[model samples]
Target: MSANSSGVVKVGVIQQANTADTDANLAKSIAQIRVAAARGAALVVLQELHRGLYFCQQEDVDQFDLAEPIPGPSTQVLGQLAKELNIVIVASLFEKRATGLHHNTAVVLERDGSIAGKYRKMHIPDDPGFYEKFYFTPGDLGFQPIETSVGKLGILVCWDQWFPEAARLMAMAGAELLIYPTAIGWNPQDEQAEKDRQRDAWTTVQRAHAIANGVPVVSVNRVGHEADPAGGAGLDFWGSSFVAGPQGEFLYRASIDQEETQVVDIDLGRSEDVRRIWPYLRDRRIDHYGDLLKIYRD
Candidate 1:
């Protein structure tokens, strides 16, 4: 653990499997955050939608009942913890913006009891077991950095992690680190090779974001088997919550099948050193990127 002039700031990740009970899930997350703070973590991140089961398995109108307001009970609890520990926290939640509007939101809680910033999930997936399009309205918050005591966090949700544009935009906005609160896993029916490929691809893409932006990347994903409400063999959430350095080196990695809380110290200033050596930002062709904003040309 390398400390700066101010002292070392340890970042924590909580990777846990979810059950059917929302209150129990929230309590478990709070306990984990307390454990992480006790271990000296200054910034802690929870897995995506940590309060309950991955209800996106099927799109029932009743599932909307799970969504709550931004400053609802969950945020209140996390905000209180953040203040009590004097630490920064990135927490994911299902936000009910209005009667008919909802969003997959990630809230950044500052060391104080106030809300720091929030980012609604931009990319909504509607795959076999992950049917998010029916529940969430695409995020209106653009790629922006949330300023906190620790550093500027470029917080994006799970599906948003795959887009380089999102990462680049955050870097352009002077974000120091790219943080993802994710809920991705493997289908039980997948072959061993396929499972390996899925996990590898997930990690590789996030690492690429770190390398390309010359910043650290922190990804916290859920673990264990979450049953698909539709039945059959459920989805197995490959834990593997990890943190990568500016040059894409692994700082810490959790197991793929257990609940773990790890507090890893990261040198926030290292990104400047890495970027000075590899000046990707200095050489970007911003003027020509107009074509990038367009859908593909035939």
Candidate 2:
């Protein structure tokens, strides 16, 4: 409802760190969301795993306890808030789909406090510090856009942001915007130069997606250092959450170490104007892209 007929929408992004206290984290998110609503945001996005600390730093059986049903308590609370504010809310969570089956999921709450849709993270990474494969089942749901009151949302999770195919699939399916609820950062062992490369690469690729698809991109990330539960050096989550326009222009960018809520107004109608000039979609060589389905050209 915050979006007018002219394709102008005010979207909000919440970037904050989490702790062991899940209740406090949710409360903090709620308060920030209210602040965004006060700023006239029609849509609000939260960072990945906002419910608690980044538990994936180590593989522990107890971490499974954090997973809850999609329509469970978190949605109930967030949905109620969305209904009260008459806005759309997109939240990322650790989903307990079934016994012995869990997935990292992003749930979208409609203006009426109903479950609009959910996207289970497809790319589950098993890297050293990010041991997500231990906890999440690779998402079965294919790349698809969820229709909301404001527009069609292409919601992806933390690691999924790295893949162009995921973004393309969503954009192809008529998504108005690409959204990433992320939890990424640096390990203490990494050098400053390495960290810079990683973070810059992260932002650059997403901006490319916006330019290619002629749609805005929104990325929300947590900020601060989350320690490894296994008593090792932890990750310093660089919370440089940002929003970019269709031409890959920066709309709003957050600081690396602060908890913040920002509302940015975007003219969604501008995508059409941009696409008319660039016409990337019209020129795609679909016949030559069959090889993209393969793991590698070799």
Candidate 3:
């Protein structure tokens, strides 16, 4: 949107399994980032909470120890990498704000190894397996795009991907691409049919975002199965990280159960082309949407 014409840009998506070892996980993420840069990726995205296991499976107060400050350890390492590779990196981490204050935040590093901008996850899930409300305070920052050297990135976390309003706001604000750093999985004990439905629904909703907004969508999800520390049935993370074109076509999609790194080239200019044919934004009826503000219109 910022005078960037339609051109091919190589985007990287990483899907990896995580363990309880914080140091080990960080090391793995750093290594894959370098691999992506080597493969000519201009911008690379890591999965949600890549620095450690999905501790939200069972929230214990002590799990707060996993959080770190924004400019803290993870940024230092990733920022330096962004500078060395001269590539934009979108990294997600659990942020420790203050005494009993924390957030699930995504940080974007510039090409010069500086903090470009950050997005606190707006929607926090509180299901039985995902007790995120116990750990993260709902993000105070509104839905906004983070400007980077490459383009204006509409960054959202795992749960935020399900909401159309979140994606629409970012697109309305001139975001060039919708990027999601996600970590979602079903209970392994669920029926196979149920698992298929859950995954399909997740994929369909994101593609709908692309089709409606006429912008490309990039989603990076974690791989492998992480057991629940609470001793309940663990979740098997379906590793289907993918990138969709402005028309909701799959540019690239990783395996469903493998640690994968893929770079997909996309035309940033396609949004303009697609909008010319299907101009949903031009025909919106904002006057009739006032009831959307009410929690329940009885």
Candidate 4:
């Protein structure tokens, strides 16, 4: 399709498999970003913690070494690539803020190779296999969108994708699109039916976010299986990375078990048209939402 009358932005999502080698992983990411740019993507987003495997699968203190400062090696490489490719890049990192302080930060690099802004993953999950709370400090930065050359991006991480409040807040704060860099998967022990339900629920919630907020949603998840460090069943990361339009329509979807770098064209002007018809934002009863701030009513 040619450029839309309302203007179009080509966004790319990179779904990749990570290994133990950090250098190799970064090289793979750089190569994928170049592929996306070659396909005419103006903005590209990599999977969560693309530098290595999902090390948060276990709460090993040794994982702390994975955290690096904002201006560290990863950002430097991504920034230079963004400049060279003239594309806005959203990258998730294990951020080493200070001594004993680290976060799951999503960094945005502008087309000029400078750090535009960042969003720390607000929702840290600590489950049976995915133990992230042990590694990341809960983000202090509120629900804010990072302004980029392409548009305002409401960047979030894996666990944060489940919360609708976060998406609404970003939409209210003028986010053009909601983006998630995620690393979620299923246990081998679970039944195939259960796994299908989990994957469906994951996609449904994010698409609902797009429908409710009148903004598009982009979710990029990792592919391949990472062995459990604690010697149990490994996780088969369901790699159905996808993009949804403002009306919650599927624009693009990647394979469940392959490394994909896909570029999808999003019409930014469609939000205006959809919002005018739905008007969910206009009909909100702000006075009754005080209960949302409470933990429980009963």
Please list the residue runs of candidate 4 whose C-alpha ends up more than 4 Å from where it truly belongs after superposition: 1-5
lDDT of 1 at 188: 92
Best by TM-score: 3
Q: What is the C-alpha RMSD of each candidate to the true structure, in Å?
A: 2.2, 1.6, 0.9, 2.3
- Model 1 ranges off by over 4 Å: 1-8
lDDT of 2 by residue, 1-298 (tens): 2221247889999999888999999999999999999999999999999999989888999889999998999999999999999999999999999998999999999999999999999999999889999999999989999999988899999889889889889988988889999999999898999999999999999999999888899999999999988888999999999999999999999998999999999888888788889998899999999998898987
Error of 4 at 292 (Å): 0.8
CA RMSD (A), model 4 = 2.3
Task: Report the lDDT tens digits of candidate 4 across residue range 108-213.
Answer: 9999999999999999999988888899999999999988778888898889999999999999998888999999999989999999999999999999999999
**Estimated TM-score for each candidate:** 0.97, 0.98, 0.98, 0.98
- Give all candidates' CA lDDT scores: 0.90, 0.93, 0.92, 0.92
Error of 2 at 73 (Å): 0.5
Q: Tens digit of lDDT per residue, candidate 3, span 1-298?
A: 2623677779989999999898999899889988999999999999999988999988798898889999998999999999999999999999999979999999999999999999999999999889999999999889989988788899999999999999999999988999999999989999999999999999999999999999999999998888888799988999899999888999988888999988889899988889999998999899999998998989
Question: How many pairs collide in each candidate, listed in order?
Answer: 0, 0, 0, 0
Identify the runs in model 3 with alpha carbons over 4 angstroms from their true place.
Answer: 1-4
1 or 2, which is superior by lDDT? 2
